[model samples]
Target: MLSGLDPSGGAGIQADIQAITSLGCHPLPVLTCLTVQDTRNVYGASPVDAELIRQQLECVADDSTIHAIKTGALGNAGIVDVVVEFIRKRPDVPVITDPVIKAAGGGDLADDALITAMKERLFPLAEMITPNGEELVILGGDADADRAAQNLMDRGCGSVLATGGHGTGVHIVNRLYNHAPDPMQWEIERIGGEYHGTGCTLAAAIAAGRATGLSARAAIAQAQNYVHRAILHALAVGKGQPVPDRGIQWER
Candidate 1:
């Protein structure tokens, strides 16, 4: 299940649906926020009612054996509280949370209270939290990824995958930090050009990989590879940034 729903199919739940299905699992979408935007910028947003969200989650949970949960762009504190309570009931399910605090086009996705709630309430329940360099700074309450990730881990999160896409460099490094002695890292040649939905795609792929029985570490690696390929074949659908071609032909 995914929380944010993008009408443009550029990111959020639509991206999650595509990525999850591409990885050979069914996508059970649950919308926590509604985004009004194209591929370029996020113009506005409105969160779905918390009670309505509860009903949707309960309905899905009752009918399906959900293997993994992916969350993104939770718009407000109300939604965060609702999700935290809901996930508390299913401690066995793996949760991959893409901490979407801002849009790729520089729009605010969450308020201060929501961010605080995520760190205080949501992080502890996550199997892994994926945050880009910028978001890591906010979540970690520090300037660097290493320090920020460590801060979050100390706050009870199971693990942190600090994405390096937002940083300037020849290669993009995605680092994974968990209970192990050392954090694992994957360095990929930077793909030229801006693309929408990469974070959503990566998180959903990780969830699908986990749902299909890959171990957490293996799932992270596989998901990274999948996102790379998707970006490699990304499409210039809108006038703004290109969108990752999640429908690019591939075998699972």
Candidate 2:
């Protein structure tokens, strides 16, 4: 997994670890950046050196049989380039990319150059790219969801999972576009109260599911269900937005 380090443990690589572990996969996290923030907001971020990230990737690859890759909050174009190159060599690995452009409480995590790098290089290698509605608009440069998803597909992304958590509605509608005649969608009832790390958890869960041999569609469904449950049991750890209970026990 490639992501930033969150000191608060509400999101970033911390969330990825929780979600992946909850789903029975051991997480091999490589920090792309270090964030200065709490549960309320992100004050700033410092990206890790590209060479250091490369070394970490190399070390992990040498020791483990990686089953899947999950990425979140890559801080800059240089880090994106490093990650893209590493992923390029592992063509068979299923990659679930959470395009975290902005923090949950409103702070830019990635700049324009990094976004461009992701679109031009990283996104194409992904098995699935999970973007919230606003991110879809920015990445695809289109207001129309379908058009935006199509735009991303044209850029070589294998599939796009456009999350609706940022959209205003009675139900959160998550749509998956994979070049089929019709997209697969799930209408989840909106759970009230803002929650941190939902995106990271969702993407990580999907990657874990994929690692366990679930198909893309099945993994998405499983992840959606997992996130919904996590949100329902969200933890009120700080002043702003609650954190998803990624480690919450399932109701038997």
Candidate 3:
């Protein structure tokens, strides 16, 4: 796992760890940046030294037999470059990237340079990218969801999972675009109220499913189900948004 640190434990690496562990996969967490944030919003962020991130990744790689990689808020272009280089060396591992451009509370987490780096370098290396509707539009550079997904695929991304949390609707729709001509989609009943760490939890759960040998389609389906259940059992941790009850038991 490569991501930022959220002290509130509502998102970022903390959320990744919880989701991965719950799904029975051991996480090898590598911090890319640190954020001063809570359930309400992100106040500020600072990227960890790129060299330090590289060293952490190298050390973890040398020590563990990595099954999957999941990345979240990489603070800058330099951090993205480091992650890209690390992923290049381990081509066999499936990578699930959550293109975190803005926080759930509407705070900007990434700028143009970092976004460009991810589009050019990191997206090509990922097995799949989990982006909400807004992120899909920004990254794909098109307003239409289908066109945006295609633009990403054209840029060498293996697949796109456009989530519907940010969209206006009665049901949350998540679509997966892959080798098939038509995309696979799931319409989950939209749970009322906002929840923090949903994107991280869903992406990490997918990584865990892939690590445990589930197919991409299966992994996506199961992960979405898992997140829905989690939100249904959410915890009122702070004044802003509820945190998913990731500890809710589920049969593996």
* Best by the TM-score measure: 3
How high is each candidate's TM-score?
Answer: 0.97, 0.97, 0.98
Ranking by TM-score: 3, 2, 1
Q: Where does candidate 3 have its weakest 10-residue lDDT segment?
A: 164-173
Better of 1 and 2 by lDDT: 2
Each candidate's lDDT (Cα)? 0.89, 0.92, 0.93
Clashes of 1: 0
- TM-score, candidate number 3: 0.98
lDDT by residue (tens digit), candidate 3, 109-131:
99999999999999999999999
Ranked by lDDT from best down, the candidates are 3, 2, 1
TM-score winner, 1 or 3 = 3
State in Å the error of residue 244, model 2: 0.7
Clash count, predicted structure 2: 0
Q: List, residue by residue over 49-117, the lDDT tens digit for candidate 2.
A: 999999999999999999999999998999998998999899999999999998877888988899999
TM-score, model 2 to reference? 0.97
Question: Candidate 1: deviation at residue 131, Å?
Answer: 0.3
Predicted model with the maximum lDDT = 3
RMSD of model 2 against the true structure: 1.2
TM-score of 1: 0.97
Model 2 — which ten-residue stretch has the worst lDDT? 243-252
